[model samples]
Target: MRQTRLRPPRLKAGDGVTVVSPSWRGGEVFPQRAARGAADLTARTGLRVSISSVKPGLCPESRAGRAEEFNRAVQDPATRAILWMIGGLTASELLPLIDYEAFGARPKVLCGYSDATVLHHALYARTGATTFYGPALLSQFAENGGTPELTMDSFAELTMRGWTGRFPTASEVIEEFVDWADDSRPRRAVPALPRKALRPGLAQGPLLAGCVPSALQLLGTPWLPDYRGHVLAFEFTDDNGYGPGQAARDLWQLRHAGLLDGVEGLVLGRPRGWSDAQREQLERIVLDVCHGTAFPIVTEFEFGHTDPVLTLPTGVPVELDNTTLTLLEPSVR
Candidate 1:
């Protein structure tokens, strides 16, 4: 018998959302900014916001404490959802200590992206609970101006309103950052471009998405989701040492790992600060590495490491065609 994927409860007005720094202590480091995010999220979703405490440092003790906090949220009935403060390199450390049983018992909306990919994949692999790849408290909600309409709309529709249908693209895009200390206005926006097709086709399958390098961390682990028959969506962050060459190697690595085997479709997010030439170069590399594969390949679908992204739900079915992406099921119960 096939197992049914678990869907968390949908959020509603007056419901509570617990904000935890499973990765970095962004809330503690930037109280004002974090508060702004909480306010905006509340205004948009009508969910009460509560910030959970996180221990400082990457020591075993701190990681354990962070996991404990996450577990507390998981087991708390009052916390209808769990939201990450921000993404960072430290999130993978908490995976070993997460109370997967508690999460499975009382699965609620778990949302975040980037480093939180470890948590998303691990929890799903262990329990099949659906989690979201969406805005973070400090990163998206705490934007200099309020969170963009495209970001919030995607988030609220899927998580709170039980919206399911074709995902919309933003009319404008913003990749530049405004200093947190001086966030008195919004980031500059440029005309939005349509998704470019590297390989044209259509398919439908369970959605699996995350930041590229972060997802690679689960390569040989029990936590990584089975990539077969899934609509895989990946995005890259320009931070650290990521460049065209690195992107090319990562794509090849994923392919070699069999992560691309039996995939229904491939969706790539637009990396921040990517020039037209760089985008074309990466596309060429993908074509080379994935040569002879027939799965549909679409690039620049507007998610991850960029302003205005879709709040994608893992473990849910979605449809991907040459021109549009559609969620086949509601993310929450």
Candidate 2:
């Protein structure tokens, strides 16, 4: 791991935010909706936003454009935080082009998920700067009506107010989904389902991890951060559900790479839209990897690729209590 510098504080009302596409660039297709989301973000929090140059590009997947835009946005003195428009499979391509030293000197909240995980790990490993695993501009902000209150609240706690506290484990389970694209669905607050604890015990360490495959893709690369003494977290989208054999293979790769050797604990989010069999298989794989290890493991905490997801801060101290199965930490400075 690289030596980390002091991180920039969370954003506040009237502060400036920059939206950039460091991986995939589909912002141009929905410029109007994207603009509305940005406006809503500003209005909801009283923060100002500047759309990065990459937002209006022809091909956001192009490595040259992404690297140039990322460098410019992070270097801009006025930009308090950077938001990714979408997570692309090609974010790793920008790694060679990224100036990690520059980011280390001026650390800010770099946020995104999925493919953005590559950048998050790269930034933290190369520069020792903290980042966030949360919703993206289009994923969370660009809803037809507005951002979900739960997402908004989590974002505020993690990014602005810095209210890092133990995430509330659901006492009673309730599950529901709103098609933000559908105007007919009433937007209402729904209770989060109770979090299931895969193993029993409390564990504490710096929070790390992201989309499973994305993190796995970086295993052999020099950019992958050293997860020693860290709490590893992972979640997967509906598109690529890992089976028993697949999950075992992935964990084997991490083990072979020495990634999980010193990991203090594991926090597995409920895989969204995964079958019961797949979930069971994943749970077994997790157990096998941690077998004989002294670290506590907690599974099925609600975060990542799911509604009502909790936002986690990378590189922050976190405590997981097995009795409650909650990941606790301060959201910000």
Q: What is the lDDT of candidate 2?
A: 0.73
Q: Please give me the total number of clashing residue pairs in predicted model 1.
A: 0
Please give the lDDT score for candidate 1.
0.86
**Tens digit per residue, CA lDDT, model 2, 11-113:** 8998888998876676776677678779878888887877787546535557888888998888888888888887877888888998788788888877788
Candidate 1 per-residue C-alpha lDDT over 246-304 given as tens digits, one digit per residue, 9 for 90 to 100: 99888889989988888889999988887889888998998998886889999988888
In TM-score terms, candidate 1 sits at 0.96
Q: Pick the candidate with the highest TM-score.
A: 1
Each model's TM-score, in the order given?
A: 0.96, 0.87
> Where does model 2 exceed 4 Å of error?
1-5, 55-60, 170-192, 240-245, 323-332
Residue 183 in candidate 2 has what lDDT? 34
lDDT of each: 0.86, 0.73
Quote the lDDT for 319 in model 2.
76
